[model samples]
Target: MAKFFKYKTTADLEAENARLNLDLRFSDDLSPLSQPVTVGTRTVGNRWCIHPMEGCDGNLDGTPGELTFRRYQRFGGGGAKLIWGEACAVNDEGRANPRQIALNPRTRDEFAKLVEQTRQAHRDSLGDDSDLLFGLQLTHSGRYSVKPIIATHDPLLDPRTVVNKATGQKVTADYPIITDDELKRLVDDYVATAKLAVEVGFDFLDVKQCHRYLLNELLGARNRPGPYGGSFENRTRLAREIFTALKAVVPSNVLLATRMNGFDSIPYHKGDNDDGQPDPWTAPLANGWGMSESDPFTPDLAEPIRWVQEMRTLGVDLVNVALGNPYAQPHFGRPFEYPPPDGYESPEHPLTGVDRHFKCAEAVQRANPGLAIVGTGYSYLQEFFPQAGAANVRDGRITFVGVGRASLAQPDWVKQLQDNGKMDRKRVCRTFSYCTALMREKNHPLGQYPTGCPPFDKEAYGEIWKEVLELKVKK
Candidate 1:
């Protein structure tokens, strides 16, 4: 309903920033981005990182499909020093979709080849792969899983959880949550997966704690009475257990990392004019990891800061900070110009959301100066993202500039910056949200449609988008 991105130059963007009184800064000197930084025992080649951008195109058997291979290969050659691999389920039932990749004995070989080819492609493109750091993100989809394995019940989110995708039935109050014993058993699955990841040549393993996945949901499980819920110590028990378990088995050189939610804002629903509006709720919210219990709309970062401190003690080398539950408030994590078909239009200016990401990440980074913190919510800045990223790195606000939707649009963004000193204007991501729309389309024979930037990577996703349109019309 509102047009936001209308800047024609850096000056215009700066004017808007001034008008909004935002802390966003930019630098013409991108040298900071090219500087190498030490992450754990390894030195990453640059500050650019490719966030785990899943295509949802893996085989039903949990092996990398053709499109999956192609996506990683492109990222390998695209020149980012750190390649954060997409989510791979710890087990079959934990999968977000039928096609989500899962690492196991049967698919171990395929994963190994994936890592090998990705490194080979990087070597072929940059003449070296020594500085490239590759890692895998392990997760259980929890509430968003195919069968909805929720951690706790929330008045706001339970009704939104899909119990049956076919009939669009949502979860009820009586729906069972994952038991504590099941959570302890799930830890074993993570340990086994971490062993497999090391064998497959991944440099790090991210026990994913973001996006309201199983582990992340556990972080906000304040109601469930067990070892894995209620108090802060109990809330973080699973992640700490997983990381401690991983450290004992894997070699010291293998880094243990987590992409965690800095703030889990309350869910927003479609309001007047189809714009996003916060769902009605009372004070002292029951389930929000890094949010204020008394005022759900505001962020209270005390717990998140403490969690990062504890992670350092457990040997976590990297911390990628994220915000919001994508299923409930997509705009909070990714500030997009448009919304997905199932999503509501952003309630506030996109710049406001971007500023939220920068401020939240800065707080965490400053709190844990020893850890390498990767900042999110940059893709919405379009061509100016590099300038903002450079300023953040120079100012010591963040260690890495990670992009997700933007990476899908232009995987070669790092190379572009290196060779041309700027991103190709035509290839820049505008935050159109087409990728999110494709991600929400689950009518495909394969259980879900593969998501990519149809506007930019037309060669791969153009036909896929066409099929989505056709399917939508039939519905």
Candidate 2:
């Protein structure tokens, strides 16, 4: 309802933010975005980072095809120093979708070629690859998996996320909890995947722990017993073990990183009654992660600070900070004016959502200034993104400004900013979330590949959406 992009100047935006009781900042000069920063041993050329966004365009067998190659090539040539590549399942059973990319002996060599070509493209455009950092995010989809192998039977997400909108029934008839022994096997899988990444020539490997994936789910496992759940140490056991094992095998130069969820809001439903805010419970909220148990919505960064300190001690090069799961609470993660197919409306102004992200990420950065932190939620700012991003980076609030959907919408955003010193409002993302809408529709029978900006790439995704709308829901 705020319609932030309507404001033309930083002062106008600041006035609006103040009126809303929001803590936000913006700088007219965007030169801070072009400044170089170091992560562990690597010196990145700029503060812009391309956050990993998977294109469901891989081969059925999980190999990178022409579309996948083209996407990375564009990102490399797009002028972001740090390219945080999209999630690639360590194994098949853990895949979120059938088309999700996976790393293995069969696909390792091809992934290597993909990485090489992307770097070559970067070199060709930027004239230097010395400070470029490329990372591959390896993950297990967990509760949202096509397999439905979950870490814990999360009461909040179980019923809501399992049902397919089309059929109004559970996709996986049997919802099974993954055992500690299976988790140990997953550790081996991660180590194996890390080894493959090193051979494939990645600068770092992201042991992904955000967005309610298997590992992130495990972090909030307060009920499940054994070495992999219950206590805080137990909940974090998998990530700690994976890092320790991986470091021993991979060469010293290959860095380790993670994309972490700073906080999680409650799952939102689509209805007139749904305000898109957390529902009040009886005092202590159950199964909450990164939030006060007493007040499920307000952030409690104590544990998250400890988690960052632990990562720093474990020698993590950087941590890309994100918030909420796109599947359950899309608005908090990616504030959009128009929701996805089965999504709820925004409960608060998009600026409030942006403020929450900045505050949470800044908390982590303040606690561990040495740990390079990549900030999300800037894409919702539209043309004013660079101004806010520059202000935050200059103030030491975040190390890098990570752009996800905006990068997909306009690949040459950073390059244009560098050349013209201003973002083209026409090409800027309006937060319509057409990309995510396409991603959600893949659950339906007539859905096409889940990638590209439908608003921008009308020929491909928009046309497919037309056919998708004509098909009947499975139920």
Candidate 3:
């Protein structure tokens, strides 16, 4: 296996970037990150955004459990002005896993308390909570859902959604796809969830359209028939309709947003050597959101650019640009030094993945200069993430630098930078993928383990990690 992270100094990291001819830049001046930015009618305190990192620790009734409260409380006190919350299903059947949080009248009170606690923690640490902007991400995990409600048949991804992994019983071609009438009902689900998010005191509501979920899958459903597929206008019909319906119901102060996939690269599998390799497919691939028809590996931003421009017209105030399907090509979205137990080794250098994120986000930002764009793929950079983020903000490449896995490792990273002008190297995430491993572990009575930085936040997750290790040994 390749051990890529060996940089002992900032200069060493820069040298490696230069060697790769990557456009990734860094700056010692971190003042740019501290500068406030305007989103909708609110002015976010800073550019450091704590991405919605799910713990999968919710109670069986869909309430925030003790660990869930602890996780968000840390993010509230972490000092990032924008806290993009994790995925909460709009309905029970939409949940990706048994433990995934679902929002409804039954669970609304708990959500309100979660929001209140998060804001209170921020006020205690930073002296004020008015400048902080928090959002809730709502999603329906399409093919990845527990029972697999797919948009269309995908030759590449179908095999991975196994009914029984040991028996290799996969989803068959005869399996039914979600109908247009069902999609219309799902739109209502999103609208209802948006209203609850506003009532719960969230600053914004993210209609999650990334990571090959239901809406994202519809975006690439060229083969499917009817008004919700085929043409570009038809493909985006559900999202447009949902956004329009949300605008009519939600108050003007509550912002409409989406975390969208800028590109859906082809799926990969473990080769003979246990390294990730792309599955075989012919040119002119039918199922990909922002990918070139002729070359599925490379990004074709034409549709994604047009979609963002359309979102601006439909009153979308924020857009978080993400890449790849985490389940299929994990390296594309999250460049990791080591792969998860269920995953394979990196197919290419992690630096290459980082560069792709920068270039794609740059294209989207330049196209839609009006929308507040949050760029992903920064967690793999570790210690120098702030420097790169500052440079990007200074260059007008992106408005916010989003940190996902790294936030679990150091929730107070924003405060650390404000005081010391650098991160605590000892606490910086090394991209070990332990969090991903925990997310995959479903041996518990509650159906899944809560994911966190076991290496850094040992007090909370060390014992949990031991439990996972023991479970693996027995398996």
Candidate of highest lDDT: 1
Off by over 4 Å in 2: 1-5, 163-175, 273-283, 443-448, 459-462, 469-475
For candidate 3, lDDT tens digit of each residue in 125-152? Answer: 9999989999999999989887789998
Extract clashing residue pairs from model 2. Answer: none
Query: What are the C-alpha RMSDs, in order, of all predicted structures?
Result: 0.8, 2.4, 1.1
TM-score of each: 0.99, 0.94, 0.98
Q: Give the number of colliding residue pairs in candidate 3.
A: 0
Clashes (backbone N, CA, C under 3 Å), per candidate, total 0, 0, 0
Q: Write the per-residue lDDT of candidate 2 for residues 350-432, one digit (tens) a residue.
A: 88899999999999999987778999999888888889999999899999999988887788788888788776667788888
Assess each prediction's global lDDT (C-alpha) against the native. 0.92, 0.83, 0.91
* Arranged by TM-score, best first: 1, 3, 2
* True-structure Cα RMSD, model 1: 0.8
- Residue 347 in candidate 3 has what lDDT? 89
Quick one: ranking by lDDT, best first? 1, 3, 2
Runs off by more than 4 Å, candidate 1: none
